[model samples]
Target chain A: MSGRGPSNYMHIGHLVIFEFVKWLQDELDAEVYIPLSDDEKYVFGKVKSLKQAYVYAIDNALDLIALGFKKGKTFFFVSTRLSEIYELSVTLSRYLTFNTVRATFGLEGEGVNSGVVFYAAVQAAHILLPTAKKGLLVLVPIAMDQDPYMRLTRDIALKAGFRKPAAIYSKYISGLTREPMSASKPETSVFLIDNEEEVRKKIWSAFTGGRPTIEEQRKLGGNPDICVVYEWLKVFVFKDLKNMNEHAYKCRSGELLCGECKRMLADALIKRLAKHKARKRQALRVIDHFFLHEVEIPSEIIKILE
Target chain B: MSGRGPSNYMHIGHLVIFEFVKWLQDELDAEVYIPLSDDEKYVFGKVKSLKQAYVYAIDNALDLIALGFKKGKTFFFVSTRLSEIYELSVTLSRYLTFNTVRATFGLEGEGVNSGVVFYAAVQAAHILLPTAKKGLLVLVPIAMDQDPYMRLTRDIALKAGFRKPAAIYSKYISGLTREPMSASKPETSVFLIDNEEEVRKKIWSAFTGGRPTIEEQRKLGGNPDICVVYEWLKVFVFKDLKNMNEHAYKCRSGELLCGECKRMLADALIKRLAKHKARKRQALRVIDHFFLHEVEIPSEIIKILE
Candidate 1:
């Protein structure tokens, strides 16, 4: 349970991942550690300063908490607050050679900053947080694009005599434009923080699989395969197989209009966003309940100060 | 007043630099900071673990304190012990881009680990430590090899709206074999921690400008220009120009034999080492006297963690 600090508001894509993590935690009956890398946000130039990243981290953490993860079991830590993470990061970095990280991150022969190169270790520290107390069966729930980071962490953990964490990768949720959902381009994403009005506006302008005219749509059935709304329904909005099947059938038969489908999505999202906003407000009050202190400092690290 | 943690013992080369720093502090009536980058030593593969490097840092600090620096004015900090330094290090790291640092350090397309890459930022933090309180004239007494780091620090500091530090470069004291003294290769350097026996042995085998045969050296004068002993005398032992001139004349005229000169150096070093040992013992008793707490955290950084 780790993510780089958000410089912008998180989109629905992040919400999907957080929901998945909560499910995994419940299934495995395991503790969750969420390390917010605010330092990385500044170091990587994603934010103007650490203060901005810190605000993002707090805002993002509130969103995660709003998803209703177990309070005592789930712990969130900011990278800047815990110096031990950086120390451990330095330790974990030793297991990875420059050549290996360069190749792994596709930075070979490229001008990657030292902070970016070193970020792998900090990320690895978050993944191996469970190993500090004692080795445990670990599972990293992440998106497919994060597979490389998981692989690197597994390699370093194994080398350091810790259990290698298993990864379960989820498919990416596409933007309304049929591209990857990104927070940087706010217009492309339906953010969890957006109000009902904003959600409806975005959905109204969203790309769809409808024909130019009603007669044309009736003659040539809509192609749900190319529809962002249909993809979103399959991945997140519509979880019931029977309901999803009916929606797909209606689209193929030209019985379901694109406007109606978009309106349905907007309504569902508006209700969901309202619920999320209330929970987020509650989460802000009890955010400290899930905060974690410094991890157990290793004896080797203790010896350093002595 | 900052140097990377010593993986091995402090050589005479380091002693020269420390003496110069002490001189500057006395002349300027200023505070001194000595940051031992134990984290970097491990990151750069100079030591096996942070523990090893930490021990080395302590030993090196003892050596510096033994040089009789003002107890209250001189501050020593290890990278692992100080969280504030890590925070400042992360802040400074952002000002440098990958292209600039890589080009400056000649790490472009090279296999340099993240620890090594990030180390430059930590080094820069030490350089800019004075800026935390108020802008003041800063003089970094460093060897010529470290000029690149100073330049990088200056560039970053100026951009960050801090006073640029001034650097005064020192000529390196060569190894007994007439090469640059390095802690990695113990045999090449006469360490401050070396015992009388080891000192005698190294000096006995030291490279000199003496001829192969004593009879040949009497006919053809010995070249003090290439003599390690003459260099040592000029730099450390015989500070007086008149005494150095006489020693050089004696060497050039073949009046002083290499063996006698070696014995003289050995005796001088043995006495100096003994004095250093006593002060080191005293330094260990009051190590806490020179320990520095976190420098005043800037409002910008405070806001980050707030």
Candidate 2:
């Protein structure tokens, strides 16, 4: 249940996931431990210095706290402080052989770095951290591409005598180019810090299949199914069944145009994520308190305990 | 400078190397950090349980403390508590490729375990942990067979951007059968707990190159160079150079017989190692103190801090 630091502005991908985690805490009676995975950012991210990584991790942690996660329900910690987890990682690595890891990852010849290979074991150890033995069902919601790592983790868990984790696979949110949205490519995705104008311009320039001429549109019909902007609406907004169905059918019939669809989806997305952004601002200001202090064990959790 | 647990009695091989470490500390002004590597013992050694390893590590730590390591000057800690070092080990491993490690250690396919490969990085990390910014000149005194690991560690240090370690290699002391003495082979090695009578009996049963008759030995000289008992005297006893050279030539010239040579070497070895055995006895009683505290940066260390 750990999150990475928001070194770059919090993008739509992060917002969607954190919101889902928050929903799980409120409805599913889950006791969540959110680790700010600053260590990963330090090693993988573009931050050239350790000091920069620390600052970036702190900034990202603030953004996460602002996303309205209840202090009592969530336990937030930085990865650097948890040395016990690293020791456990070494123990886990010792039990797994190199051939087994290579087969699991599909790595061939010299393509894999030792860091990437051992990183799978480190991730597996994270799931079995002492805090994870709370007897609650563990659920990890990550992008579909990251499934290989989670699958490897499940295999390692069986050997280590720990329970396997259940996962929720979410599809990637695409960018203006209709390619997978990456935080590194800021222009393609809307960040939490993006203002109203930037959000509008990105949507306006977004790749769509609709034509300008009425004859061409009628002949071809706008393929709303292939449009990245339309998919964004389905994932982020227009959750109502009747409204979504009507929009999809109308767009396919050439009754609705690309410009109209883009503007409507943009408006809905901004409205849907606005509350989270405001909270993110507040979270950043008081981050020191949230990260350093232990929160109360919620009454609901205690009742389940009793 | 991590020490092994003392609950299991140390053999002569352990004594020889430990004595060398003591000499280095006295003459080289070395600041020794002894990690009671109980975690390693639990994972790899005969101890099947963590509880056993914990107890054993404590016992051994006390034994090492009694060997005259200054309390403030020499720091001792358990491997489990020193998570920072383990984390650094993981980081160091990333910089080292498998090819480089395999080449350095002369490991072939299936020849190396993941732990064995990772341990070299851990050993390198151990040498660098005390000083992060500045380099250090580490000296490791071990048996000749262990030279490969030290050599690998030195190469890893160069690649990992740390200080190189210098090694002082000592040859193994052979058993009564003229084979390398091993703790696993108890009859061949005299433990610290061995009584005087047992020591005398073992020496008496020891193999020698002595002839059947003194008359035959006077004409045909004993092979002092090939004799295990004679070599023990040259390596472990007879500190005075003049007397040792005189005895070596005399033995070769048929001046000293094998029976007399065994008694003299055994007496010198027993007398020389007497203090270590006494200290080991006192160590076993107070082994509890070694595991009582955590490793902290001492004031003196901080004064010359990285």
Candidate 3:
């Protein structure tokens, strides 16, 4: 399972994460549970308003659906869109304490809002929801920085009588610049929503591992280890990268230049994003099918909505 | 608007509050919104579990319904019984800060849970909900200790662009033992659901402001000023208190003894409770009509509960 805040459009960092999720889904035919935490983003100030976050969730969901996951097996739940997740989050919040959430999220002495503190439980509820509903143990794909949330969820799940979900922790996908490719810096990451020209511009202006001049680069060779475009190519574009280490070797031998590599990645990314953009348009019409609403709200609770 | 964390059965204190609510409704033809904070009770450890809190909310609601609140104007919403409140709470929580909540609640270093902190927002949402839906500012009746909640809600409502609610504050209703009548000391409270025998037992053994000996009392007169029975009689039982100073005068003149007062109060209470219990039984069947379901949940959210 993999999901995001959905307050911002899906970027290159998010694209790689979903690619990994799709890869796992293909290999195991496992059910995918994607929770768009619009509440978290809105409350945490990632988005200006909940309505915007919710709108972005649908927009980002279209992008995810475009990735070609099996529709029948994939379930998407937006935080504010679904009431059960809030209900489940409240249930999970009981077993978690303020100090635990604060200390776990390294929020001690910080002046974060109540929603920020409660967001940990919402995230935990997302992880354990499959276990609660389907009795299926979830295998979440997250980055190493999110270990605390995983650990916190595992601990709370044990106390709450839900199965602890297994997780695959990977490193942060470095940005095109020195900083991480995150919502904080829009220029560092290429968004799926970006047009071909925008994608090409972001890729062309991206940071790379190269010498000052072509003569020095030919003498000392270019360093592919630190090249953002090469890294993106290895992680997402070229699926068979184990054998494609030759690309890196060619760079080291000065057979490949930074401009030449940027063009190659930009072409491949433009092609992929073009196809994704087309599918995203088609996916928009069927967005309703992806949000499963099989929530077992108590009959008494049903009266609240009457 | 009046509500309590429904983790316990309604007692004498609660009865008085609701009586005040009924008085306002009768006088002004006001619409009453009673939200049983089951989530608050469970999260704050007032109840053993959310399920138990919810059950108690429904049961307490029956006692409230029996009090003869107008079915059409009276609205009953249990915290766990509703989804919109949670959504509304999240919306209100955005403008509130943890420091403000902690300082307002004086929960600085305490080990309160995340839900406990977020409950302030939940309560604010409850107060602002009427305004949010019908643009009717709420007039909440609360004791002095709950002023903080009202103040917090008013501040948040202003920030959230909702009209601030007005409040009428009263002092703590003294308990039978000089302590406040609350859930903590069951012996001090006469529950609406208490049987005739229990009512008689509790009222008879209650504290009173009488002299040590009957002879001393006869010579000096009893002090009705500090008497619990007199307080209950003056506050709830006898509505015409301006003329009922004669009863206190009788106690002061030693004409009315503690036994006579207890017997009068107990008999009156037992009769009132008996009527309430009878209506409570009838209330069970018609409770559904009181819970209005005209919640304007967005179509997007409707898919979440599908």
Candidate 4:
């Protein structure tokens, strides 16, 4: 249920993950705990100052809040301020060795920082936090990139006398340009904070699997397989394959033009983002409601060491 | 200023370091800060449980207090209990990369654990704790084994806009058997808690420079240079070169018997340890006075980041 603390504003890519988490919570009647790793971002060299990272944590939390999570059911914490979690991280770090982390992360050399190495333990703490309740089935909805961390968490959690928390992996949602979505590349992704005009502009210039010429596209047909806009529709707009199959069929048969697809996505994104923008404004007003005062370790887990 | 947390009972080997630390505090009028790294010991696989490490910390602290460090000028903390230190460690851990720690610690292939690797940051936090006050000169008196950590601490402290801590290195005091003193080889070391009978037995079996036969020793003189008794006498009992020279001369001339030298050292040690033992019992009654509630991060250091 935890998400990485964004060093910058989160884009639509992050929104998709939050949406899935919300769905899981509604379906299973689950509670979510999100730890904001501002300390981590500073240690990872992502932000120059801890204050800057702290601000990002707040902004990112607000973004999640704007996604319409139930206030009482969701809790957020910043790592540096949470001493209990840091202490737990120390305990978890002991269960793992340097070779295991290096092997798990493919960081067998000089580039990794001690902070980054220690962060694996902090991440593991997040995974096992719910197990304090014992028999609480925890389902982590994460992107495919986080699978390695999940594997490490599962291994260490079992060793520390906790149930193996399950990980539900999802694919990476590509950028508007069909490249990896990164905060550093502003043009490639649609930010949650992007205005209607900005969203339209980004989608209009996005990468699509259409032909170079309009006449060629009509004769040879267009392809939606590699289209970022189509992928967005498949992940966010359509819930069933029936409508998705129709869209793809029409796209491949040249009945749906690239411009028409782009217009449809842009309109839907604008409508969705406008509602999210309003919710974000509301979230900023009640930011304090979502933060956890302190993280509680389960007495059952504490008794193991005792 | 920074001392490692003791993992087991403090032996006579640790007394030498305490004596020097007491001398430095008096000579330089310096404040002493010692962090008990029970976490480090657990991470290093020295102790099975943190509770065991915690008990070692209490016993070790009593030993240090027995050496006569003034309460007002001294402070002690266990790493697991100090959240401020853990926070500071995260800040410092980010300044250097994994390659830096690996290169500094000679951890080429990585049999080391994550806790031990992260402890480098925890250790660094201890070094820089005093810099909260502007322009404080920190003098760390440690054995040769800790030089690598001191070097890393100094580098990170300077980079973090603080004074580079100065280290005063001392040689390791060998065991009675002439090997490095370790808790693993309990027979080789004289524990502070050892009774008079135990001390006498250990000393009586200790290595010396005397020849196998009295007739051989009378013809070819004993070599005091390789004698453990002479080394102990040189390091602990006798400070003056004149007195040391007389002892060596007596051994070389075959004027001193191995039995006589062992008896002399045992008596001196038993007397010294008895006094230390009495003070240690008294120290346990006032252990709380030496613990720091929270290590204050100096306003000057905070301003640098601000």
Candidate 5:
């Protein structure tokens, strides 16, 4: 299962992991659960409000649905929209504590984020919810930095009367500048919504394996190891070893120029995203097939809302 | 409005506040909202499990419904059963901080109760939920010790864009032993469900202001000021100045014997509870008139429970 924080727009950085999830779905015939942490983004103070996060979450869901996940197999929801998540979170929170959260997340002594403190349990609940529903093995594909939440969920799973959810860690995807990709920073990442020209411009300006001058690049060859374009090329352009190896060899032997490589990466991204944008527009019509619209909350209790 | 934590049976200590709430309901033509904190009881570690707390909460609701709160004007719900409370809580939690909660609740450095930490926000949500529904004046009939929750709600009221709920503090209702009444200890509290024999036995052994010897008590008179029986008489038996003052006068002047006064208190309690138990039995049939049944949780989302 996989989820994303909807504090920012879905960008290429997000697509790298989503592509992995899609591949898992295809190979294993896996059922996918994507729970957007709209509640967390607001509680963690990442967004101005839960509404704003939810708005972004809906858009992100469209982007994910556009990625060609199986209709019956994929279940998409945001945290607040799915009542079971909150119920499960409160149930799991019985085994969680403020001290454990503080210590695990480095929140000790700087005590002003109770929502965040409780949110750790919410994160744990996200991992174990599938197990809570049925007797099944739940596996999460997560980045290394988020392993703590998975570890905490695993530690308390049996105690909370569920199977311990397993996790496979993924490496972080760096930005074009070799730093972590930030959704809020537009220049550091390629957005899924960015047009072909925007994609080309961003790719052309992207960091690459190149020397100070053409003569030096030809003499010393280029350094693919430090090239951001080469890194993304491995992720986006070439999935096969033969094509990937050929591109790397050309860059290292000074047979391929940085401009030509950038153009290749840009063309690949434009073609992929153009198809994605078309599917995203189509995803809007069939959103109900994925979203959770009903829950356990009693309706008669509403007096003023009417 | 007033609510009792359903970690234990509905006892006399709880009745003191509920009776006051009933008075407010009668005098002000007010809308009553009683939200049993089933979530807090488990999160606060007061109950063994959320299920246990919910079981107790449902029974407590029956006891409360037996008290004859105006059917249409009164609304009763437990935390988890009402999806709207959790939604509002997440919205309000944005304004609450860990530092503020820790310092405000003396939870600083004691990291292990993230549920309790967030449960504070649930408490605020309960207080503000009525206000969130409409432009209404909310007055909570709370015991003195629980004022911190009220204060916290008020502090964040406008920041969350709701009217600040008002509060009228009730003095602590001490147990038969002159300590705070605890539902966990059956002897200290007279549960609404307790039979006549149990009520009589408890009151007979209850603490009193009588002298050690009969001759000394007659010579100096009993001190009604410290008498648990007399304290309860003011709440349960006497609703007027003449009877209350006359009872106190008799005790102070040695006209009312300790045994006789205990019998009076016990009889009053037995009579009151007998009627309450009968209504509670009847309340079972019309429970839907009070309990919140349907909510926002979509049925399609419940994959495993089916």
Candidate 6:
């Protein structure tokens, strides 16, 4: 997977979804090639220096490694460092016309940069690189809004003599006001850096459709099905089915209040993301060594080219 | 300057123009950087493999070296192997909009390719490489038809924070039909590999505006200025002002017949290009090493980023 490193310092959304990457490695027995696309970071992320992007990639990769991924079992690489990857991208970009790329991305005027255009081809190449021999079932987990890029990747892959990747779409978790939660909108989502108190405060202020008065809520009952907090609890917390169903039924029958429900959800989320913070800290400590020695292109490959 | 190598053997046009490059080193006391743009060559030149292009670039560079260019004074590089050059090109491409490039190159839909678009940026970057800080006075002794590219480079330099390059345009030495000489069109130009007998035969058949009969020619003189053979002598041979003017006046006054003029020009060209044949043979000897080492980016630069 190639993209800018998560900007919100890795939240519940990152933890909940990326846990599947670990599951794929251990249970499904797949050799995961995680291309930490510092290329994307330089183009889209706030960073300007390619070196800074390289270091950030190392930090991000170490976080992934700490999630029980064996070092050799998973391959990590930066996009700019790989010549074959860039060449492949240039070739693919040649095949795709400007009109096609413009239409796909809704680009007009001067909005589209060469980096963005080449980036699409790079993304397409990434999906095909792993399955160069074909017939490999490649699964991409992405937000629903990013479906357009996946569709474009599938199209380019079909034309570039490669296998198409299947995608698993996931919805974005919204804030209390039902507004889409984004890293750009700091107040909307709880970041990994947030303390227990901050997480609790954010959850308490979250918008819910529950009644203001206890008497009114008892008569009408709360609709937990459409509640953002309830959805978060189901998606991020309550791994056991029995516990999840009990909470759902209690909320629908007005047996539980909104305040109590938020408290329970926030506590579970805080516990779930607590380990990543320690792991991130540890990853930062050994980052220099990883950046210098571990992330280097294989010497054998360099010798062969030489 | 990275490009796929030439598919066909080098022609007189290639040899004659490159000779001026040697002159730049011999007379001007300048540092030379030759980039074998294999990436551009792959897209434009009809070569089978990128490796083949690399081999061709090495061969060509060695030929230039054999022409008496000092090793350390003149550097050789390939486009695909130099990521820093490509990175700079990519950055410069951003500053240049698609419309500006398209308009500058007079590119229509048929001529527009990703390679062509990126190549302009690469060429622009080549003229501005930081190593060229000694004031880039690029003496491009190309055909007048290629003046647009030099004009574009000059314009780009005005906007870009880099030194502008100067160009020296040479008129095309065309074939019997007044068509621009090209290796692709075998009848249009002589190849370095062409035999002496074949060279004589081509010169005999070459076009000239002379009277059909010698008696008529004495009455109505030939237009030596329009004759391809005479132009070749003036451009390639007869460099002295007195000799060139004497030849031109004699032909115009019908003192020298068209057949005699063709014979003299052919003999001079054959003698002049003889040195290149030996250099070409030597160039092939070290071609492998040239391809292997010429274009690779320095490890020190990569280390700096790390």
Question: Among these predicted structures, which one has the highest DockQ?
Answer: 5
Instruction: Give candidate 3 regions above 4 Å deviation.
Output: A108-110, A209-222, A249-260, A292-306, B108-110, B209-221, B249-257, B292-306
Cα TM-score of candidate 5 = 0.88
User: What's model 3's lDDT at B32?
Assistant: 96
DockQ of each: 0.40, 0.22, 0.46, 0.44, 0.51, 0.25
TM-score of each: 0.77, 0.76, 0.86, 0.75, 0.88, 0.77
Task: State the lDDT of candidate 2 residue by residue for B47-155, as single tens digits.
Answer: 5544455555554554466667654556666655565665566556656666666666676663343554555566666656655533456666666765666776676
Instruction: Write model 1 residue lDDT over A212-299, tens digit each, in one string.
Output: 8988788887888889888777776786988888898899899988998888888888888888888877876677788875333224
Tens-digit lDDT track of model 1 for B1-306? 556465766887788888888888889878888888878788878888876776677777878988888988888887866766766778887776666777788974656667777778878888887675446567888878888899999998987778888888888777988877777777777887788889999999888999999998888879998999888768768969999999989888889899988988889888888888888777776777887743222243223222
lDDT of each: 0.78, 0.64, 0.80, 0.80, 0.80, 0.64
lDDT of 5: 0.80
Q: Write the per-residue lDDT of candidate 3 for residues A32-113, one digit (tens) a residue.
A: 9999888888787788877677667777777788888887889998776566676678788888888888877777574777
- Cα lDDT of model 4 by residue, A83-173, tens digit: 6666678778877877888888887475777888888898887777767534566788888888998999999988888888898888788
Candidate 2: where are CA atoms >4 Å away? Answer: A2-10, A34-57, A70-81, A130-137, A193-197, A209-223, A242-306, B1-9, B35-59, B77-80, B108-113, B131-134, B193-205, B208-239, B242-306
- Tell me the alpha-carbon RMSD of every candidate: 8.4, 7.9, 6.7, 8.8, 5.8, 7.3
In candidate 1, residue B237 scores what lDDT?
83
Error (Å) of candidate 2 at residue A271 is 6.5
The best candidate by TM-score is 5
Query: What is candidate 6's CA lDDT for residue B32?
Result: 65
